[model samples]
Target: MFDISGREWIEEEYLRLHEQGLVQEKDVVKVIGVHNQMCERCLNQSDEWFGTFTYKEQLITYCRQCLDFKMVDNCHYLYRSLMPAKITDNAHVLNIDFKLSSLQQRASDFAKEILEANDLGLIWAVCDASV
Candidate 1:
């Protein structure tokens, strides 16, 4: 089951991977065990080793570079760190739906634009889809 945000869910998966030896403890980069506490990306960046906790299930390890950008508002990495409930009032039900809708619309619009563009080729098409 998922918590308020998708990040927690990913953390849980990381922990499982750690326990299974699919990921080492050193693979995690940052951990903010506290609920709603802001993360310190600079401090987090100093650490080279990380492992997700089986109980907490969030990234517990990160290098300085990754951590430095973790808290940036427009960063895609930061978006990954966001907990669903933290971003929305009704995470499990309402907020996720809203976010998905927004993402789908963006994807649809981008696809349409790509299709309409004459100069873009296969490689560019794949990159566009990733965005």
Candidate 2:
């Protein structure tokens, strides 16, 4: 079977995978609830970005932030495969010919720390408009 871990799909996609025998019913996991005040996919917490609609006599809530990519809402389920027991660690090397400034070096070091811990971190750097 193909590796589906670290991937998220919709209900229809999961059903297709099941029909293809790539994924079993027990292997699928629903990650979030419908009518969620916050969007689990995009982490959009703004209430104004969410909308409700009637479907089959049921009110369904959806996240607009990620709607362009896929319909993320209560009526549809976000499916994910179960994580593997052991994950292999690979060395991630940063290849830069030029030396980084002190500020950039600090950000790079911080990113490495968070990545080693398997946590989320964002390093925002604004380049000059002229560049």
Candidate 3:
């Protein structure tokens, strides 16, 4: 089996991997729960956004919010790896032509610090140039 941990895939991609023997049904993590009628992938539970259609003589519920990206439905499944993806400390290079404002610089610094420390944090920066 190929290493496909820590990632979610739609049904078509999952089936391709399964056909290559890189993944299996048992290894898939379903992205939606039938009992709850909620899409685990997008966490959408709005009844208005969900609809059913007949496919192969079976009715299938699908999430309209995530449909543009990929079809997430009741009869089908979203697949994720059972194992965690490997983490690396590889340095990432950023290439940008524009300079950041003072506020943006501070926010960027804070974000970098949190990532380097492997800590969880949120930075909110609001800008109103017209003000």
Over 2-76, each residue of candidate 3 has an lDDT whose tens digit, in order, gives 677787888788888889888877776866432277876677889998888898899888888667667788876
Q: Which one wins on TM-score?
A: 2
* TM-score of model number 3: 0.56
* Model 1 per-residue lDDT at 15: 63
Rank candidates, TM-score, best first. 2, 3, 1
13-124, model 1: which lDDT tens digit per residue? 5566557765544434444432232233332322233323332454433332333223221111221333333644543243433233555666556666776784332212
Task: Flag the better candidate by TM-score, 2 or 3.
Answer: 2
Comparing candidate 1 with candidate 2, which one achieves the higher TM-score? 2
Lowest-lDDT window of 10 residues in candidate 1?
70-79
The models' CA-based lDDT, in order, is 0.37, 0.75, 0.75
RMSD of each candidate?
16.3, 5.8, 7.6
Tens digits of lDDT, candidate 2, 1-131: 58876666788788898899988878767866344487776777898888889999998888886777678887677887786533556436558797788888788899989988998766667764221
Ordering by lDDT: 2, 3, 1
- Give the Å shift of residue 29 in candidate 1: 0.8
